[model samples]
Target: MSAPVCTIDATGIHVPSYDDVLAYFQTEFRGIYGSDVYLGNDSQDGQWVAILALAHYDSCTMAAAVYNSYSPTTGQGAGLSSNVKINGIARAIPTHSTVDLTIIGQAGTVISTGIATDGTHRWFLPSTVTIPPGGEIIVTASAEDAGAVEADPGTITTIGTPTRGWQTVTNVLAATAGAPVESDADLRRRQKVSTALPSLTVLEGIAGAVATIEGVTRYAPYENDTNVTDGDGVPPHSIAMVVEGGDAQAIAVAIASKKTPGAYTYGTTAEVVTDRYGLDHTIRFFRPTAKRVKVEISLTALTGYTSGIGTEIQTAVAQWLSELAIGEDVRYFRIAVPANLDNGADSKTYTLTDMQIAFNGDPLGYVDLTIAFNEAAFADPADITLVVT
Candidate 1:
């Protein structure tokens, strides 16, 4: 009597079905116990055969999982993390949001434990900040709570821990949004991009090198190879790199290492890199301007509907917007996909009647929104409005 076996070949791993395994077991039992032996549903032997079949099916599934673990594309969790190591990258951990805060006070004043708030979340200053002769100091503040905590300009007006000479605190610009734990989909995408580090084209190599930098969450590189500057404002024979997160010096070094010798680097942030030859070179890159997106979703509630489900839909839409790549346009229908995903059965509780999107301060419409090459679309869950009837 032969047992059911999973096959692995050039095509892929082929698993045996439970029914196939059961039939094989039944045939073998008949071959041993005699041709006329009864193996009905009520018989003890029948029950034993069903259990054995299920066990064999589980074994086959485990084998398939093992095979998939060897490849980054099919692996998950720890297996995926291990495979990405070959590309010199790792899973990105959660990061805290940062903002540049203006602290005004008398000259020579020193603050040891400074904290600011935007009414909801707390942002912490460095261990100490001394007001320069200018009577005010601009310092970067990290959000006390990690992950996408946003504060608009001038919103952080409250000084949580007031010092004797510290008069007021406020943020000059919007907070640079933080990110949650990197998802498997994002990791795989980065892994693929990293493989271009040694590609034939210089542009691909530059993009690949920048993508692997530590703390760098998302990046896009554009090249203007022609004689004149491109429409995106990249100089001729130069590259413009738009990166969301990373150390300035590390980004400059990565760009300098992979960029063409005479080609220009363009953007707002500039870091000076000294070559081994003792020559100083300036590398420039852009920090993307986050354009907050507004989402309006109208749906009809069905059975099992709840306000919690509506919140889930809003989160799903916001997350989808956040994941769009630099310069990627926001499509009108794309917003519907995430909202209707099977998020713990919440998606089934409502039927979408209409969906619309717009940039901050713009009227919401059912039209695709264009994103500039140097800008990225950001959506806060609070900005996602759901109308459920």
Candidate 2:
């Protein structure tokens, strides 16, 4: 059988005379860097001449189609982002935690600082970001660095995603008896939801790797790992995320939890002297670390329980779920007073008919939790029916 022909940007030639294509890549490389060429065996292995482009390729459509670049680390985002809010949880540090956000263009233009463009619209780092163990934070952005600018029209990149997390958690809240902060595995699981990129910054070196004529660069896929630590009020757990999944929220949750376990310098000069010029500067100050927790919304139905004070449990459940998803503080449920306890006219059977449990953030695609509460503390208690959606 004859060997497969060599091709670059369409024109097919024998492997021996492929220097013409090599020269073409030099032009693109010079535009990005002064001079760099790292080719491969073929576009797949050496970009020189191995075989196959895609994991599976259609020889008929090589130019008008995407390069067969399927590997453990292949470019996956060829389309626009779908409406998907990646979800993940993290633990809070008794002290502080961090939150990071990153916005990237699969194929867009580049701008100064950390902002980028598609020549039409402006995009910011991870548009929607959050800090677990909920608290306040400050945010900012800057380009990867000034020295490295000349990027593709629709492919400029940033250094690391904008990171903001909570810290210095004073006033330790009492821990829940039955359920404590999440475990280490739980934290790692959350981090997995974030994007996993090879470099927080789109390394200037990468342009060289991609444009290699007869060379290749072995790229490693991104990985998320959980780091455990000593958190004061909450059991220690930490995580880190990337932009590989375009899942910065997941990473924000992970980093907030893990980083809390360590000690950080207060937002002041290390000199120990107080600053009169700028002690209140938000940017200079650092946040106390915190742990993030995964939250689920499932309403509980109260049986034979009626709110003499006109408290509707269904409405309360919905409100609680919203707070939980946003990592807000919530306290609810007031039992009857001692005098009104079992033996009284107030004593009546109440049946909590039905409660629909769902997530606050991603309501459209989640399982609802069903709960039933029976009022055994009352005598002849009046039954109350409840419904939730």
Candidate 3:
């Protein structure tokens, strides 16, 4: 038998397998000792050689892992986190959801501090607020705990803090849902875009800048450089940015800094950003409208199938849909990949028979969804219907 050795070449690093290393050690033993000597698997010398070969094989594997850690595509976990720093970006930590709460109270009422709740989650107000002449004030409240706390319109009506002269609290709009810790895959994508910050196009630079903002989960930038309004209703010489999960003021500042001079920003959400001379410029951008997507999956149970497998499929599908980029369409075939994720039991438990998707509780269809540029797709595990046969 031939000896196997770790080597690096033009293709890539190659580490010898444990079997290969064991075979090489066996061969060397035969060469050193007499060819007639017993070297069966149960022999003491054979067992000793196997143990030594395993240690050497482990070292070779470690060397390969260390080599791959330098590249973003191959690196993972802490290694990937370190490599992305060269692009001036870091992994986004989980954040709390926020909503604008409409506080109605007596005129001149002073709230040193307050708390609101939707029954399920608690929201915290800023340190102080005073009711103006109108006796109504809108304050942004953040979730007490981080990560995906959602409060729908009018749901946060309970005043958790009993303050004098404070009457009622409610949110007219849904809360901006928070995000989980950034994954390695998401970090790599951001690192790729960050390189374009100093690129030739202004739009790419704006996008690259937005990608680095803390708590910014996803975003897209569109430019209408032509002389007339474009197909997406963006005015001429303007840019429209659709963003999800970030501080509004930070996004506006990034746009104000990177956008071309005299170019207009087109969107529904407006934030006033101050320039170097202290001039306030109202920057416009869009906050993505969430569209709930419904999915139905049909599968036939096999030898090891159980109710738990059905639940896993639902979770996997929901996660994939929620992770779609801004303006990204939900394809029909893509959902199947997650429903049949390659977990050890997936193949043995069941085979997917049919899959369908729909929007807004509409009838499930075999067609793909065409999501608007400013609309983001969201899916809940409860909305995922799994039928086991």
Q: Highest lDDT among the candidates is held by which one?
A: 3
Return the TM-score for each candidate structure.
0.84, 0.18, 0.87
lDDT of 3: 0.86
Q: For candidate 1, lDDT tens digit of each residue in 1-389?
A: 56778898998899988889989988988888887877778989898888888888999999999999889899999999999999899998898887767889999999996899999999888888888787876666788987877888789999999898899998756777787788898899999999999999998898999888756777898988899978888888888999877656678899999987788999976667899999989898887778889998889999999898888888888888988999999998878788896545777788999888899899989899999998889887898998878
Better of 1 and 2 by lDDT: 1
Candidate 2: residue 111 Cα off by (Å): 20
Winner of 2 and 3 under lDDT:
3
Please name the candidate that would achieve the greatest TM-score relative to the true structure: 3
- lDDT (C-alpha) at residue 375 in model 3: 82
Candidate 3 structure quality by residue, lDDT tens digits, 184-303:
988999999999899999999999999898878879898888999988889999999998866676888999999988889999777678999999898999878778899989899998
CA lDDT of 69 in candidate 1? 89
The true-versus-predicted C-alpha distance at residue 243 of model 2, in Å, is: 24
As for TM-score, the candidate ahead, 1 or 2, is 1
Per-prediction RMSD in angstroms? Answer: 4.2, 27.4, 3.3
